[model samples]
Target: MPDTASDTTTGYQVLARRYRSKTFGEVVGQESIAETLERAIDRGRTAHAYLFCGTRGVGKTSMARIFAQALNVTDEQAEEVAVGDAILRGEDMDVVEIDGASNNGVQDARDLIANASIRPARSPFKIYIIDEVHMLSNAAFNALLKTMEEPPSHVKFILCTTEPHKVLPTIQSRCQRFDFRPISVARIAEHLTAVLGSESIEADEAVVLRVARLANGSMRDGLSILERVVAAADGRLDAALLERVLGVPPEDIVKDVASAIGAGDPAATLRAMATLLAEGLAPERALDGIAERFRLLLAARVCGDDPALLGTGSEESAALVEESSAFEAEQLVHMIALCDAAGGRVRVSASPRAILDAAVTRMALSERFARAASLLAGDVTVSSGATSKKKSLKVADSTRPTPPARPASPPVIESAPEAAPE
Candidate 1:
């Protein structure tokens, strides 16, 4: 449910709001938690307080509304989700939503404590949803502790927070806690595909996958990115169009940079860096992309090239495996480190391109050093043992002997020189 109060003034609804989950089944990527809550609802064993914890955009608040709706729905109104919609829109009187960030003072807590004893206005339960509950002051939490511990049978409390660690242990002990996990990229991509189908919008699969990756486990963010893409693209969504929209360097350009580093070509590495900068790709973002590829390659070497685990398409994973063969696992780890260091520096550096170029060049040189050292050491494979500490990989070449000792000519040379002087 969305706030329909201001759409006349704004004239539009964002996709995230328009397609918000209306039912438990519609909430993607949180099946386990949803099932648990639904079971609780069915059993009529609702907890007095629930602490919903997770990262932002993972629907802690939405789940709270769902629980509230399930608890308060009547026989006649079972078909209609108006109560749930009202709670979602923050317009319900009985289901009050308090922004802990704004009303986190002692007075606000006292007011809430006073109201906690009252019965519901319309529904069976009076639900108080506190968003970002960790923002509440110490005194405020203390004030609510008594009510939360022993509230009226008709009252329920739902507290949502991104930072659960900041919440007091005493408060948490009195509530049922559910930790929400981040949505996977594949789940998000499927949702995006369905959304595009609903809108009759044509988008390339690659573009959707890229958007999902960019979303980084947030469905709201993925929808927001899709909204921007839909607004920007008059026709179908394609790789080239998305690249421009996201300011991401082309995949080929990033691959070329990786290839150069793998093949130990410093000039090519710098050229790739220049191309990325010329394409208006941020240095930090470029480094991150490079680092991700290296990470995928390392994973391929260790984890057997599974696309799902790698979070890349089959073709891309194959390409990574092929490119990854150029350097040892140790070299890939070193490359990732260089990328991480350069990424940190580019954030504050005035000349980011220079820093990026240096980083890539350094990665290439590192490959050279690894190759040279391996050759000199008789193709020794450097690997860590059972412990985290590094172990020396020494390969002894018995054929390569120590050089013969020089003849003892020093005594004769000194005597001859003395005779000449005399």
Candidate 2:
């Protein structure tokens, strides 16, 4: 008997794999590029060689496959779901997927060139999809240049890369390039919401939003996160479970620390951080949460308090807007920098707690400086921390001794007499 346990036919399909876009219409967060490509297909203006480039998991490879499908897909197959599935599964002989990072030698390029010359096994057009195309050796690129520049009329090349700049300029010049942008947090959340509904799994909107933000603009990553959360939830996924699963602190923890920093209270800030540590939150976790919070606050400061732009719920948006008022734009920028630097240091530093503490304290001190500046400028408004019955911050006083009254203008009568003589 065959090894049934090892068979993939009965294996579980990951959400990312199950929901991979089979048609252009199913693609998310790249509507403009999809529309442009659709128009090109309609007009029969498809380029011989195409370059698709973007950050990881942003659908560079998927779009390449879709383009290939569109090129070779028959009019009959256009409306057939099985045909589309076959194309996505790479079961169609005409569409070949090549990993450029592995087959990066000159010999591989030569083999590709030879293969390009051959006619399609079944479909009208022979398509080659090479992913991470930048990893190909210089010699391989040189060998492929001539054919890439002028290939057989029936042959199509779709080059996908995360770092397009690494590809040789000559090769890039020979192809029509389309840049895939990072999907926005909102689009990812919207897709995740639909995904949860499709799975019949109930998830709090906050959980979905958190997952979207955590994915950092990668649909594949968002789906993966959703899959993990669903697997762990047993049915219902909420913000608490999501945070626990992600090793992130609670929203209130971050908000408290932010409010403390805004209040210019080092003691309160450190106290909040200590509470987080005592609760088993790692220093890096705290730092990441704080950094993310500052990012939203900064966005709110710059983006006119739009909840969509901040990618937050109504309550969170209100909190962000309120927190945004606690600091000047420059102060937010400075705090973000401090948190970022601390984050970098904590990754390698021997004492992450020390670094995090210092970072939070530095932010609090910065607020104090801003408050002192305002006080010096005759703005009596100071930070709450600055006003203490036990201790007071004496500003520049805004009072000068009147400069001795300028000696009464040195007797204007004598000056008038001198003017008459002159």
Candidate 3:
């Protein structure tokens, strides 16, 4: 009989597993890592010690579990071990996962080494999954290193950690390392849709996408957000509920503001912001939303390989890259810093609109106006104030490759035109 744990009928299926990609074919993105691991398994060149490193919510732990499931198998009832099962049963005994923070002691390391000597009771080899191995104390690491160098031929070890630098260099040298990258927002969105559908949850795609973007490339985080949305959506998983629950501003709304800013329309930008405020959007959340989008745009613009990871549309991606090409990297860096500083203040300020407005005002003039002032002083002769002024340029919401010049708009003098030149 198949394991009773395989039951999918109940709502107990967490988003992580409901959306878990068991085989390499199912895992989206991370093609390079997957392909390399798959090849290692196929060729029997698998290393005795393996190090899987990446950020939390990425696939370090999941991939570790997958590797354990792949290289070690079992007889349904007995302790017989097999290889190449192609599926990892969640309850397999051959696979033991250790939480390093809780179990990082010399005693625990010794116990693991002792267990490593014993052959798989029913599977081909006993697989140990040590998560957050960097937390292991120096003594614990030393105890484990001896066994790691020459564990029994049938025994395999997989260590997953977010901070590989803390791991002893000797341990790192012993393992075949594969770096897992954060999942793209599109991939996370795609996964969320499949998981929500599997659970028969009634949620809008926009809501799901919002949670995915908030997850910030962590599949685990995305799932957690999905679970929250499922509970708070009250049977109608709309975008508003998701944002409210997460204390986040809607990505689309932020994109609209970015679009307005990119188009160099001060009136339109302020109008959109006002609409958001009128609709009861928190000023702090609003600025945070803008900050997130701008940061993502900065990343996408610099790294042209994956815009989807940045939650950027195809058209927007093109525009953003074009905008990014205008300034030296330092300009974007400074803009993000200013927005971040403003966001920090807005989060705590009673008047968030004022704070955000100050941020946007600074962004527009921080570099350009200063430079223009210098030029007017006859210190320089540069004529490209238009390019330097768009702190919001990286979002690329405009249709043109680059936004139109904004120097055409001048503040009204109010005074008569020099009183007919005196």
Candidate 2 residue spans exceeding 4 A from truth: 1-9, 76-83, 302-304, 369-422
Tell me the alpha-carbon RMSD of every candidate: 10.6, 6.3, 15.7
**Local accuracy of candidate 2 as per-residue lDDT tens digits, 306-370:** 87888878777877887888877887888878878888899999998888998999898884565
How many residue pairs clash per model?
0, 0, 8
Poorest 10 consecutive residues by lDDT, candidate 2: 1-10
What is the per-residue lDDT of model 1 for residues 1-422, given as tens digits with 9 covering 90 to 100?
Answer: 33342443456778887778877888888989899999988898889999999998887887888778877777666534676668767788788899999999999999988887888876899999999999999999998888999999899999999999999999999999999999998899899888888777899887888898888888999999998888899899998888888777688788888888878789988888788778877889889889877887898877766777766677777877777787788888888998888889999999987888878888889844665776677574454552233223443544468799988766544445555565
Alpha-carbon shift of residue 358 in model 3 (angstroms): 3.3
Model 3: CA > 4 A from native: 1-11, 74-90, 200-205, 234-237, 251-284, 295-334, 344-357, 364-368, 375-422
TM-score of each: 0.84, 0.84, 0.70
> Candidate 2: TM-score?
0.84
lDDT at position 276, candidate 2: 75
Q: Kindly report which residue pairs in candidate 3 clash with one another.
A: 79-121, 79-122, 80-122, 80-123, 81-122, 81-123, 81-124, 82-124
Give the Å shift of residue 284 in candidate 3. Answer: 5.4
lDDT of 3 at 309: 55
lDDT of each: 0.84, 0.82, 0.72
